[model samples]
Target: MSAPDPLHDLGVRADADGGLLRLWSEHATAVELVVFAADDLDWAIDRVAAERDEHGVWRARSARLVPGAHYGVRVDGPAGPAHAFNPVHTLLDPYATGLARADDGSWRGVALAPLDAPADRVYEAAARPPAPRIPLDRTVVYEAHVRGFSRRNPAVPAELRGTYAGLAHDASIEHLTRLGVTTVELLPVHAFVSEERLVRQGRPNYWGYNTLAFFAPHAPYATTDAQAAGPAAVRDEFAAMVDGLHRAGLEVVLDVVYNHTAEEGRHGPTFSFRGIDNAGYYRHGVDGEYFDTTGCGNTLDFGGEPARRLVLDSMRYWAGEVGVDGFRLDLAATLGRDEDGGFDAEHPLLRAMLDDPVIGATKLIAEPWDVGPGGWQTGNFPAGFTEWNDRYRDRMRDFWLSDLRRERETGSAGSGIGRFATRLAGSANTFAQERGPLASLNFITAHDGFTLADLTAYDVKHNEGNGEDNRDGTDANRSYNHGVEGRTDDPEILAARRRSIRNLLGTLLLSAGVPMLTAGDEVGRSQAGNNNAYCHDSELTWLDWSWGEDARRLLATARHLIRLRAENPALRPVRYGVFGETTPSATQMDWYNADGATMTIDDWNSPAERTLQYLAASTPETEGPNRILLVVHAHEAPTEVVLPAHDGVDRYVLLWDSAAESPDADDAPGAPASETRPAESRPGERVGVAAQSMRLYRAEGAR
Candidate 1:
């Protein structure tokens, strides 16, 4: 038996003699660097045994360790599940800047870590594309999966389909630009490994929240040629993609999952973090067992310096090297946990990110909770950080799904318009005034749950496609199908579905806080009622770009709504302050209902009342005082609500109507709805909104 090497002790040096790359396998008695020929697929021309340093790091300096060379590490040591020290197995190099895939569907480490693949190849650092960095106040995030986004685009090149290049193509860029989203927050792009269990079941981990290497972009997304060229090529392709997207004027934000690793349970793979320093990297029980904070098997001990550094370094790498504009930290509360294994709002990692100059301007959004104690941190994050407002999701769901359903079934709408109004005004009670309304990243549908279509098409989740029966996802989903579940050719039901979707999208775009629209929602993408379609890497989950008339209408409506939000700064108020013009604006909101009267507390509690009206007047504050009136009626029977003319405002104009096939041009700022005063609710003209619809009117001559 030979002595083990201190893996971390070895140092890498680059000079005229090619470049030196090393992996420290402290417990491994022997380490071999397997270098593959750059032009050949099936051969490695060189094998050099790595010498060990006192700290147990394996080191080797050779002309063969050049930048373009592909390589892997084979380590021999005490064998274990958490520590698979195999001598014969060619392991992917942890520090390999480039990687490739073998015939066996496994990643092959690239020895030459740069795209050019030469000893003298100058390594260019990753850079941010020249995209506009939209302010937090104006951001409307579109959460999308990279592959799914491009897979169905016919305009994209066949060879580039489902690749980073495809996403960067003019077709994809044009779609986004037309959609009017300033930022595209992609699902995890970091390197991820499919769960062995799922692989055996013939499904891949498509959502990619399960990260294998935080520093590496997922290789599968690169072009086939790039993948063949190895990790460096893959990286270059990704960088080029971001640069292309930036040039198109859209910012790229990442959905980063740092709370846990792909190293699942205690029997997971020996990836970099686990093998490098198990005890120092992961949170453990009293007897040195794993503590699962993320419910993803093992949690990173962010309290430990090594684990903290890993996260911080990864963030810096993506922001600085990868040119990402911002990050939405998955289970962010876990990163703020203290040494005692409890969450701390002032954790060093949080403080450091807040203070880091390079990443300071980048948007920092928190998922805000974990599976650990006190995990639901909602508004608990420090100021300057925005959080995904789950409360907003629930309330909106209630308004359009539950409350709407309750209104139809029981002939009454429970809950006050005030609650919905609060969320619309950015939930002042939940988020602080200093943090402003933008602190709430309001969303109705996300990657984890039902699509906007399914939210109104299915009452319960159908996750059978996930291969987990139906028990895997959240059962407390607050969704509602107007009359029938799943798909139906019934015209009436179909019309209702469209109306519900319009309602949800309208609320999301018009809400006071920042809005995040899940991709495919605007295009009527459905997962066949499967809310948890995380594993289906097929068309069932991808956006069907082949335009249907209804889908096109929805897309157009969404675009107009987004443009409205961008043009009307008053819609995105930073704060709902005192009812005046200076400093604190966005406070001039008036509430009314059918019969044209201010809503009283009794009106809110009355279930019989299913109609309401709202007029938002933005004062001449930093944002604005643009005024618009919205009327909503959720009734099975057609009812006309009297138009409430404001005190100093006369002649209401029509700007938009959900029931209309398209937005009325007269619905623009100058040309409002009808000025006929809604005909005084004449003989059943109660301001007739169909069974379920919303209408908006812009009025002039403010009081």
Candidate 2:
């Protein structure tokens, strides 16, 4: 109300007016902005009664909104779940970039006028600044939640554990670096509101997917020092985390949920955007009713100009202000829908992301589909973007799990060598040549589903702890428990599971496209059967640093596989070459069966043939210095297959064998197993693959 008011320094800035604050409470009979002294949290100097407009908006102009000032909004009105307006309750401003929680869990908003805080200066002034933007071609993405990644680590300090600074600690970085992923794809870190049910149960949304403020980092993940610094401090800490990751040469990609907000239907809380402009921001039914796309209450309507601006502005803020290297847009198809409800690949929001100069270099990946009608847009995204390849997930699962189960139980294999070869070579059939192989973001496991370990250790999803009566999580998991369900001490069963993990990892790393590995998958982390650990914040979600012998072995195997992927150009193909003929700069991938002959159509559609040999030779013009051959055997029984002995190649080398207790040293490819394959061999003379495993070979001299 007077000169030097923190509100003047902290409030929103406008060209004409110095600072401004707006309240979005339609049911409130009265609303007042209460500004408090910085040092004394309990006392307030004055209250500014809001001026309501024709649209029921309440706003006040003042220069007192500066950093360090404490404030809250006191609204007088109705109270209940559907009608949440308590005049006695002094609510924290939902738009407060900074927050300080009181003893009672209520927050004191930061002083307002400082829109141009110190944190904002550092972000806008910094140039290139060494942020790691790993190319999708050579990327091995490790998906994780910031808090869950460090919560269980003993090496990280107790107080900092599960916080943003905690994740940037050397202990966590060392673990990820040792595991060998180029990018750490973090789950949603945007500010979010916990569901009332979760709060009552004393549980928080561990995944943080229900975003409340797209521009603000969730304050809980910040350290005490950061939290005390207010919103500016939280922003600085987040930027510092990105700086640390970039210094370590690891890219930071975010799993963004722009499809929906924390607002749950019409009954949800009045938080941020929903309270700011509900009717204009959210998509609704024909009669200006409820939103139906997200099933999670409400979906953001990208159909409108103002909504599109909000989305584009948020994206730019994260990419430029927060300094994220890339983004994986959740339920992206929902963002492409028009007012008439038709999805457009060239939607204005999507186009702006592709063309925005400030953030154009940032990697753009789409979850590709939504729960809406005509939502399955798999390979339909425009060029310059990548998509999560769910088809590849199912196919790979069927190849190693379901197919191997059929082989063991019925003494007959399922599926073919040809289709398996396509997945290995980037699933060109699914993505066109123009969009190229990078169009596919391939993965066998994701955060929403089972880990690679569980994919082979559990046949059915065990999600009893989710409190959803097992109705939650996906049932079409395409998994195989491999002889025994859950944990088992049986030596044979344990050995099979290990091999299966290696096989899956091998397939993922060896496949052409951008590969995303779920956090803890490298070390064989399990959710104890809970596929959707969205709410459980304990060990169910944390990455366990202390691992057993099998987990350690899997970690080593994963590292070796990632190194192999990085070194081999053939494995990270950006373009889809001619399948039947040679194409420049692209390797011609060939397929064969146990009988040592080219695969036919019958071999593919048949649910009886599970073994395949994959041969890839670079085109003569663009062969460069890398060439290799990879073979896969998806069977329970030991099978001896002859090498092709192509006219040019005389011998081959063994680079890796998933069946081996450990990865074997390099060996020539085409030569007989007894001759060139000189690594530790099993009792049998044939190249034996413990059921549900894969192996890689490199071709040498020409015959």
Candidate 3:
């Protein structure tokens, strides 16, 4: 077998006696470990020359390099087309667990003391009460920014607001639990800094995608006390937060950025990777120009051994040492690119991640695309990975929003219920048979796009506040403002908008794939029509807990929809069904038109025919047999639909109405039990459906 990998343990490690520093550089002629004075970071107290081993790893040791010592590495290497090496440049360790900004505006690594107990024991103790390990079919993910999530919550302490502790506060947990989401997917928490361009423009990179350090918790996100107490304290606070969330039965998922670093283009700052070994760390063209895949200026060379080791190590640290239950990989397509810059389904790094015992147990999600050539790889990831389904988001938006706009302006919807129906049943055409519907992560809105309320209130993006002259966000919003754009006092317009919210929410929760809800969508939050609000950190991005009557109604409707999804097995399927055969955990679907007969090919593809009755019966392996009937009418005008008659069904009970202001008049708990009047209806009976509405009914078989 080949020699063991020397890149392992490639950062500062403290022990009872002293500390050891390991740096990896294939081309370095000389590497030195420079120790700085704690009082004056710019003053180097001592420098020890590191010896290079056969495996290209430079190693050094010192008693002065003990815990809390500030240090950096200086490497001298031959300069060439693919390299940008400077002997005097002090580079931060790539695997630095703690970092400190020096007085000269540079960075230094801080050696952290050994924990009171073993790292695994500490993490396990902190993660007491444990994650509920909610099944993928039963999981509902709520994506939120850690700072924006509890920043404005009046119940959270003022000092703790906008911090990790704030998110673990009782008020925040209560809101999430009451909303019925099982997991909270947080935006990037890796230590990041504002981009050079944004810093020059007096703005900040609010989304935290520009990762500066992979193994460190962002110090600024902690309370002032924690920040002042240093990196160890910051880490403790983060651990406490995870423990609190786990105790409350809510899982935490982190949005991880590994495709690119904070270091931008060729002329960008030489902080860590660039100063150490540019050629070995980053992707570059033969002519020495950076191959910027991901559109973030520089892409990490995943094909390189050292780079792959770094990513795998960081993931292991986060999953085992920190208590996160899952990860959402940003710009994941870049991670699968080979040395030739071509996409590979079984890339070494990707396979390593799936096979690694430590990282493989946790949930893995991929954004599945980047800005590079041939970057859209949706439904093309490995078996255990779930990918964000942009197709689902687009088609749902088109059917409900853009189609409505076309119907009013051109007297045609421009599409039919066929495409929408396929998506509702989990986009079988998109994902593979073995992977099934769970491979598709469905969402109508996310942190990078327009809120659900804005989708029904704005036809075009109003991004003037983004300082790009309304050109910063995507123009293909697929949104409609009913009859008017922006805010309007017209009661009819307001009513239609509210109904649209209910319809979209219902579609997301009742679909066959995993649903991800943007944090504030349940309360009808809007970004003032700004589809891209990545730069804003003020009240514009925070979740406003205070709500009006309409918003409250929307929140109530969301809770009811989630409950319905939990109670109905026909809505969430683990596998696709085969015709004339039963499959465990699969849904057998039937389609019909307004006349109650089996749907014709014309009904599926005709744009003018936008109404359909969907009947689904679940062949559950563990749960009870269940069935549901969904009536969809997307036309601008009302339609009368005749319920379809099936052999085993006798009555249809009304479960939910998207057209109603509330789920039920009295809002009684548990499946609208009292509203069973329209509940008991014989097949072939005609029901009046409002314009652009969805009606759900529970089918009761003969008993």
Candidate 4:
């Protein structure tokens, strides 16, 4: 047929005797393979010339390319506006399965030992737990930083603290299992380096978005013993960590930054991608200037075949080799940009991500936007991918925090209850009917924003420590400090803040979509209003193990909410219900005003209409028939709501109450499986709903 694809078997294909190294650099004229001395990376042991094929792939065979060998490639090419091939600068293989840093801080491709597939599948209780392929509809993501998660936890061993092993420790696993989260979405674990600006400022890139190498696990995240043992050992430790999480039935989802590399802006550094093929790897104008949609300086040109393949290969490796269950593509809009420099839902790389069997079979989630034009693609991603619902986040924050503040200032909130109700019922107007509610990965707080507690205590971002003088984070933070800024001794103020947090959490779990909880939010963790705490790897970012009475109550509330979500099928719908036709696996919704009557247009739009009731009954496909009635009150004043009357429904059992201090409160429901039962209510029952709070009830009946 046609010429064989040179991209096939890229990276090192090694065995004991020797191996072949294939690298793609379209602009390079001469590519040379340099093998460094195993003991001393500075010393070169072998230099071999590579021959380029028609596809611009340079190939070289070396016995030195076996397991544990250290090597770098030196490329020389024509000096042009688009080309920056440096013969002196040693560049890492784009397809490197591993990476290592030299004493002088230069990086080389690590030739890690091949993993044993047979051994990996053997699950002798805890040896290598199989991946828990939980369905997307049932997935509950708990986003956490690998290092920060257990760094400050006293229960984790000192030696293992802040490492991948630390996150996989038994104590760490127990905490997640107890909290009832199904998936652990860790921040970028990809081998990353500090941005040149942060490095100069003597701060670290704590979030790991500045990816150095996509395929290699961050060596620093491995234990000291694993780090010294080299990249292969680091990978083993990472795999073990995944296995441990799997043992606890927790899926590991990595926040992967494939949109850009650690090689920042034009003046930044020449580590790997730049030295080899700057013109080809990065998106550039006709004059060779970079187009940075990622906000990370150099955006990896997924428009190119080689660059697109790079991402596919990385996914295959991480999913197939290291055992990651899913990936939350960071600034994913960059990945969808085509050769024409416009984002397309069906962009080749994006399509390949879902079409490729190895990656497509696993869960795929997208952050869905970047800093590029038309970048706010909130619900624009394809059906198979779940997008981080920023709209949901903003609306929830606004309804509870900002709207309440507006009510206090002008006696009227800017918005009515209509939009909030839409978000709470999974934003059918935002996501497509085919994708349904699950496509909306709803969250009130993520790693990038203020914690749940901070959202109610800070009116403005306090990010002076980020070195940008409070100019780094988003100013459009829909947050409100109640009566006073920061912490206060006012019990009423504190009580109000706690009630708001509970309301936000209740809305998130009872909503008709997959929910992602920021790791420390359940326990009211605060960064003291530092919304952009991306630089400091200190106590401000870590998940603290210790908690006071308030934090413990919040934790119990979160657990109960999660348990309620798992038990009630109506709360999480797989399909958006059609008005008249009953869609299988969908939720039939009925909206009611505070008077228990069908909500009129005025009732939905009026600023005074702060009270609404949502009744969702699931048209079950796999699960048994289920229905939930949620009462929402956003006004500062306490109000009474009449429970909506439904046909053949006897009474509603109070499953949860935001006004209740904790889930164990007499009126509120605890876990579904718990022996303690909740209070019951009849149709048209007038219930007292607290200021800015919600009450969830199970509609018990056989219609």
Q: What is the C-alpha lDDT of each candidate?
A: 0.76, 0.74, 0.88, 0.88
**Tens digits of per-residue lDDT for model 4, 1-703:** 8977768888888865687888888888999998999889989988889999988899998988887789999999988777787798888887777887779888889877556623333222234667889987788999999999999999999999999999999989999999999999989998889988898899999999988888888888899988887787788888888988998999999999999888888777888888888888999987777998988788989889989999999999999878899999999999999997899999999899899998998889999999998888889999789999999999998898899899899988888999998998889999988889999999999999799999999999999999998889888889988989999999999999999999989888888888999989999999999999999899999888889999999999999898889988888888888889979988899999998999999998887788999999986788888889989888878899889999867899988889889988655554343757667889988988888888888998854
In candidate 2, what are the lDDT values of residues 1-703, reduced to their tens digit? 5554111122233333334666554556677777767766667766788777644456766555555566777776554433445555566664565665555555566642232343545334354367766767778889988988898899999988988889889998998888789898889988887876777777788887788766678888888877876677777778778887888899998888888887676766665454434566678765556556766777888887656766776777678766788899999999888887778999988888899886578989999898888888888888878999999999888887887887778787646666777777888888878888899999998888887888878988888887778998988888889888899989988888777788888898899889989988988888877777788888777889898877776787788788878766777776778646656657667677666577777876666677777777664343364556676777666777666545455565667778765552233232235546544322112454445567776665642
- Report the backbone clash tally of model 4: 0
Cα deviation of 525 in candidate 2 (Å)? 1.0
TM-score of 2: 0.86
Ranked candidates, highest lDDT first: 3, 4, 1, 2
**Candidate 4 residue runs with Cα over 4 Å from true position:** 1-3, 117-127, 666-676
- lDDT string for model 3 (1-703, tens) is 9977677888888777678999999988899999999888899988999999998899989788987788999989897888888988888988888889997788998887534445533334423566667888888999999999889999999999999999999999998899899988999999999888888878888989999999988888899998897787788788788889888888889999999999988889889998888898999987778998888899999988888899899999888877688899999999999988888989998999899988888889999998888999998999889899999999999998888888888999899999999999999999998998999999999999789999999988999887778888899988889888889999999998888888899999989999999999999998999998888999999999888988888888899899889899999999988899888898999999988889999888888888989999996888998999999999989999999999799988888888888875563222366553455677999988888999889999888
Task: Mark the regions of model 3 whose C-alpha exceeds 4 Å error after superposition.
Answer: 1-3, 113-127, 666-671, 674-678
Residue 499 error for model 4, in Å?
Answer: 0.6
Q: Model 1 segments beyond 4 Å from truth?
A: 1-63, 71-96, 101-129, 579-581, 584-587, 605-610, 619-624, 645-648, 664-688
Query: Per-residue lDDT for 475-510 in model 1, tens only?
Result: 767888878999999998898888889888988998
lDDT of 2 at 680: 33
Q: lDDT (0-100) at residue 79 of candidate 3?
A: 77
**Among all candidates shown, the one with the greatest TM-score:** 4
> Global CA lDDT of candidate 1, please?
0.76
- lDDT of candidate 4 at residue 109, scale 0 to 100: 93
Mark the regions of model 2 whose C-alpha exceeds 4 Å error after superposition: 1-11, 14-60, 69-96, 100-128, 286-288, 579-584, 619-623, 664-691
